[model samples]
Target: MPADTARGRLPGFFYRFAHPALAVVSTVGSLLWLAGFALAGAGVALRASDPTTAYALFYYGSLVSLAGIAGIAAVVAYLVVLWLLRDVLDVLDWEKPEPGARR
Candidate 1:
């Protein structure tokens, strides 16, 4: 999903950090995500320019792209773990209930 749509996230569809920190992390993650698309696109375009070079470029691009995705997944895993224990961490929470409201 586009970074802008982070605000569009519906309650309960997914969990998110209620703190401002999530904004910074989300933006950075989105920008870093573009590397995958760029590499894959370059690989696609290179194919018509030169067959032999295209194979190498595509091969490496695919590897790099997959690595980038894996890194992102790892980060998400870390955040998920933290989020699940937000009450104990006392740092971030997915939502803030109203005053006197039950969580």
Candidate 2:
């Protein structure tokens, strides 16, 4: 039987929901990282005009960039875990006979 038609429904449900949710999170993280780069650039420009304010902007921008990196790493780690689960499921399903496979 196909993977989706397996007796246990939990794996199917997780495969359906988790993939898209992770994709959304990864996309948002990438956007945040890009925004951080822009902020850093603005901070550089401000450095020439106002040294004190520029320092604050640079500090906060670095923080934002670090957060973005963390988010991306988390998403990647989760995806790897999901892939491992999928492989395990595939192995189990392969070993088990389908509904009417046996004579």
Candidate 3:
């Protein structure tokens, strides 16, 4: 006899709750990530060249370049984080109080 089952699976209810939560979290996380990348990109552009040059490069060169890199990073990061959480997030047990204390 052979085991017949999916290697990794989450409960349906868990998915129902997690789908919306993940969407909300991923949306906010992505925005924050991109905003930080934008700010940092601007800062680098400003530091790398003069104000006039920075304006030109930022508006033209850096925007396109950083956009591609940041987009890739965001996708990879989101996937990796979600994959790592696969096991940990499925557990629903609550932590017990300290051993010395009564409830």
Candidate that scores best on lDDT: 2
**TM-score for predicted model 3 compared with the true structure:** 0.31
* Residue lDDT tens for model 2, 5-102: 55666455545553667765776788888878888888899999998888888888888888888889999998777667666545333344478785
lDDT of the candidates, in the order given: 0.64, 0.74, 0.56
- In angstroms, the error of model 2 at 55 is 1.0
Alpha carbon lDDT of residue 87, candidate 2?
68
Candidate 2 TM-score, true structure as reference: 0.64
Q: TM-score winner between 2 and 3, please give it.
A: 2
Angstrom error of the Cα, residue 20, model 1: value is 9.3
Best by TM-score: 2
Model 3 misplaced stretches (Cα beyond 4 Å): 1-18, 48-103
Query: By the lDDT metric, which is better: model 1 or model 2?
Result: 2
All candidates in order of TM-score, best leading: 2, 1, 3
Task: Indicate the worst ten consecutive residues by lDDT in candidate 1.
Answer: 11-20
Give per-residue CA lDDT, model 3, range 64-93, as digits (tens): 545555655665687677666664684435
**1-103: candidate 1 lDDT, tens digit per residue:** 4554646654323344444455455445555557657766776888887778767766776666666566667667877888677866766755767899853
**Looking at model 2, how many pairs of residues clash?**
0
Query: In candidate 3, which residue pairs clash?
Result: none
Arrange candidates, best lDDT first: 2, 1, 3
Backbone N/Cα/C clashes per model: 0, 0, 0
Q: Is candidate 1 or candidate 3 better by TM-score?
A: 1
